[model samples]
Target: MFRRARFAVLFGVIFLVILRYYTTTRHSILDVTEGKTSGPWREEWGHPIKTKQSKGANDTVHDESDEYVNYLRVLHRKHGFTNDVPVATRRIKAKYSKPPLKARPSLAQVKNPLFKDPLGFTRARLDSDNIWLPAHAEIPPLSLPIARTGPRPSSIDASSLLFGISTTYARLTYANNALLSDWAAWLTDGRGSSNGAGLVLTLHGATESQVKTIRDELHHLGIDVTLTASAEGETDAGGRYAQLVQQMMRQRHREPDRKWFALVDDDVFFPCMGRLLSRLQKFDTSETHYVGVPSERADWVIDHGTAITYGGAAIFMTAPMLDTSGQLLCLQYTKTSGQTGLADEEDPGVGMAWDEGLSECLARNTPDIKMDVLPGLFSPTTANAQTNIDDVQRGGGYASGALPLALHRYRNYHRFEAGKGHAVTSACGEDCFLQRFLFKDGWVLVNGYTLTRYDGGVTAEKVTVQTPKKKSGGADSKGAVKPSERLRIVDAEDVNPKERYALSWKGKKKTWRLLDARVKENGEVWQAYVNRRGGGNTVGGDMDDRRPGDIVHHAEEEKSDVDSVILLIWEGEGEK
Candidate 1:
């Protein structure tokens, strides 16, 4: 009995050791899609089994959890128990740990499976958010030669012209002095004159000293000088100013009798004054009221007017043109309001109002006057009090190709403290609003080679003010201002000769034949006609042969008489 009991104990020990070995060697199968694990077990007959469950229930029924636990126990027996085993109460909870979070898909990942990778996901995110990204590949460098088609014709004449200067102040230290001198010199040079013989200087609000200096300087150069001034504390400075100018003109007009009057501001400079003036002198004004300088701000409402706003500083007006309408033009421009201390703003509604009103008054009051335009003459110059002779030299005098004709120094007076300023520059601010308005009404402006610096005893920087657009409806439907519409014309005006010629062929055999025989109008090809018979049999030969008197189809292209046209003739043989 003792021997048998000992043998049974040895058998149980061996069995336990074998079971632990199998458990340690086996792996657990995890169901990633279901977010769970099948647990660990030993294979029996190619199937996993739980030692405890197999003994208690039918072996055919598999229990994953039971199998897992049994396998753990077997491993503990063979490899020694580890602290990693969970407590009995925590095992169940651990099996159902929070379900794995789902990943969010990107736009590209959703669109293409191949782009489902992380890199593609990043790109898709950036693209969907409208973020800029670097290109994936480097671009090859291009090597091409620039070819000139032909030489352009010169449209401007460089001699014998007149320029005008307009001003409200005539002080020596005013910022426009240097500018005016430069303009005078440029005009003299451009006109090929030894002296500024035709240059007319018109001054407004001239002090006694200022008038004396201007008259003396201009007199020495043989140039005409007209100084207009108002009495101290006058209520109507504009009217007085106008009267003074007229008086000066009458005095000069009665003398040598000048043919043209150049109206210029005291502070205007003329860098290219000579070239522009020379060009102006060559223009035929018999059909126009005035020939104006080219300007960026041109208005369309002024009749016979080209949009080229000139600086009130420098404009060229014919003596006859002004004599005919000068009084009425001055009358219409007369100030209706008392001087307001508001020097920082433009008084469009005050001192001087509608540009159209001024133009209309001139047109109605003077019936024989016409107008033309000069190109590229006037530009605003430095108007700051801090500008000096040195600054003018560094900035290039009015004669510099890029220099502006008119400079405004008025703002410097109000902005910065006096005495602390250096030299004055620019009279009309940077944009020169007044210059634009005048140019739009057909006025000639010139910036000569000389600098006309103003030392108006004030210092200030110009500021831009935005005007709110008026609403069309009530507050509820208010909207921002709409941009003006633009029209584009294309055809012979835009296309080249060779390209235009090829466009005449419409692909239809009949149309092609008609186009081949068409003649050109001016220098461009006119309309073409195509034969319209079903084939060639109805007209003459076989169906394949060309025919006449069938039906005629016209070419798509047509040209006006003023444009150039080409004549086309058929070269190959065809049935008549």
Candidate 2:
């Protein structure tokens, strides 16, 4: 029985030892996969080191079993216990010289099944096993290369430019109308004109005199004036006026050669002809088909009349823009359809509507043709014509003034008259009519001073006076003083030739003298001398026995000698 019991005990001890060894090996494998293992079990720096078991103890122990077990577990996880792992290890030939630095496969190689398959399958294996190979090829080539190009040239003809003018009936009066005629003539003459650009006179009604004057003036200036008379006897209402003007423009466009047309009013004036031509010349007819002189109408106060459009009186239209065929649709759209409320009283005149209408038409039909408002090119003078009482008071007043560049509410009777009763100096006369118009259109009315007079309507008369003065003895008056010979004392200093003058007294000499005297008179000069220290007495007594403050006269003497001199003196006590 004792022998059997000892055998059982031995068997149990062997089983327990085997169980502990298996658990230890499994634990080591877990530690290595979880990155908790040290020494050879780690990815790099795998060599094991000897160390003391406790913090300060001098004792040490061999840990080769633990390290060896960890290494075997790592090998099992990486190589799946395959004979290939052992063969790969032998082929690489692990050496004590740095263990090959544990090189990682490149992305290309790792992505390729032949080198990177975790199952150890090569490209040949994929092919034989009917597995689809993934592709890593470059993207398909792009279609083709395109070449770059430069901007295209403008199709506009700079030679054939046209301009138009806008104005009301009343503003173009006699003087203003004449001024406009003169301006047109100047422009046509090419001396101070728009370089021979075609001139067109657009008016509300064609008066016989206005037409004749404008025609003659424009003819003289060398401008071919096309007088576009408004439809006769038509009432100014609704879009009818604008429509009629558009129709007229369409008719004018029939002539394909007419390049540009400028919109001008009868009251508009041009100050510098060179500046006007320069502005018209720089116009980009190719790109911007419609251009105008911008004007401010919101703040514009027409004291004598009504405010017109916000745009200046002048507008220039290119030839191509007048080609109505291209803008037919846009024009049709602009035409009122069944009483659209958008067409209100604010709608500009027919010509103005045509100008603005062309902008919208070109924008929609021919977008390439831009619309620009030239800066500082035209000025609206009508805005300046709305003068207040204060302006007249400060400026003294005006008479027969030059016509403004433009004018509002101009009447035919406002012309300057020498004897007319209505000659109150204000800005609203016929003179400012043209000035105001041209000013509103951005065409600066330069030389404004040359156009009008500052003072007018006043008259004057001539008068003569004589005064007696003491004269030197003549041949007929031996001992008898010749009744204080008559002398003429003229008030020549009244003109105030010198802006300022000074008077001083010499205390030491008891005398006073005039300095820088600009005297012009027919009389003898005698200065008043006073001796203030001698009891307020007067010195340099005169022959007339005049008091100190009394007038002393000197007259022309016929005698050759006798010291023909006279002096005047005054006495004062507090002259110090």
Candidate 3:
């Protein structure tokens, strides 16, 4: 009996030893299969570092596990997975009108399985800025408030000009409040937008609420916009930029009426949209054309493999160039291979700079297309080279008889600065224009005098006044100089020999009349008082200023000097 009991105990002990060995071997196999067995999971700098692996009994785990891990990583960085998340756009109620339509689902939301929510926020891990979202994959539809509630402007011809501005959410306020406001005033308050013009804004990581805000504030500008989030796992900067280019191409396809398509930074300034369009009219948009001020940093395209289209000022492409198959090829490359070429990589995201990426795209897809360095597109002053706004504008010396197409680096100028009516010290002279008039930037100085009077109108008239002569004891009894009469130049020394000037007088009845005047580069000769009506107000003003020229009143008394000139024209002259 004792021997049998001992045998049973030995058999039990052997079974227990086999069980322990099998368990140890299985754990070791899992360690080898999995990358590495780390410590307990922990958060580091908003990114979740998973240290421990799941010890689940089941082998076939859902792919969502990895996705959830990524989601957690982004969530911690953004909001720490807060349950008290504020419902965006929930408080925006339409009291005067019905609430805006629910935002359309983004392309990524519709196509990518990773983005489950249609319009809801998704953590797109792109760059250190945490900007990209899945919504960036598709282009926003062409949506703009119509003139008579019709489709987008379809009238296309050689004079057609399109403006495409690139911006981001962090800079949204500047774009809408400052830039767009200035643009609208130029279009509505000034005649700069006369030649057919279209504006489009492209933004990234723009939520529905943000889009609604921009649309509501800028509806009157007749501008179209494409606002979307970046793609998921598109950690590379180039990937996000490629997506922007694709959207621009798609926008051009949608609007076939424009001849020239200009891509610019949000801070860029279109001093005079009309003049820019006219200059563009000189170029053939149907041919392959790439226009921009080349950057010094673009020299490394061959060795370091980076090219850039000095985007601070402007980047332009003819409609034909954008319509080419090469652009489509670039689009495909961005979509398939990825914008930054790091979306599918196992390592961290390294985004390509937009300027470099765009340069590469244009070169690779359309090698025949040559990038034209247009010095006129940038401001002559170096201060305006980047997006710096502290100094005179890049194109501040615009009225120096040199018409620049665009000015880069208005980002630093606040709306208040533009409103202060301060002329650029470097550009302004006694009778010379100080700075280019960005209609929104204070008063328009023509020949160093405010173009429009306080009443905001420009009217032409003819007047006669006594010319100023050397005080050679030629004074009347009333202490007025009874000198020979000619024409009056605001300041003879500052006026150019070739340029024309006008003397404006506000009659007792508030009627403004313009008198033509002559100026010589040398202070040898100039007009004292202009008594003849030659040209009308250069800029149109708000409604009530338009009046018949037949109401011209005679000059009551010859003013000593016609310094404060005001153009007496009304909004009726505004075509739109």
lDDT per residue as tens, model 3, 481-508: 2212211111111111112222233432
Alpha-carbon lDDT, every model: 0.27, 0.28, 0.34
Off by over 4 Å in 2: 1-161, 165-173, 190-195, 202-223, 233-258, 280-283, 295-310, 324-342, 345-370, 377-447, 450-576
Candidate 1 on 1-576: residue-level lDDT in tens? 999999999999999999987775311110110112111111121234333322222122234344333333333333222223221100000011123212100000011111111111111111121211112112111111111111011122222333334444434434324333333333332122333344434445567777677766555433444444454434243333344346545644454444454454443333333334444556444423454332211211111211123223233555555555455644423343433211113654343322223333455656454444332322111112122122233322211222222243312211111110110111111111111000111211111111111112111222322223433331112221221111111111110111100001222221111111111121111111112223211122232222232121123222111111111111111111
**Higher-ranked by TM-score: 1 or 2:** 1
- For lDDT, the strongest prediction is 3
List runs of model 1 lying over 4 Å from the truth. Answer: 1-171, 175-184, 187-194, 198-210, 213-228, 233-241, 248-252, 255-257, 285-288, 294-313, 327-349, 353-360, 363-370, 377-576
At residue 43, candidate 3 shows an lDDT of 15
Indicate the residue-level lDDT of 252 in model 3. Answer: 71
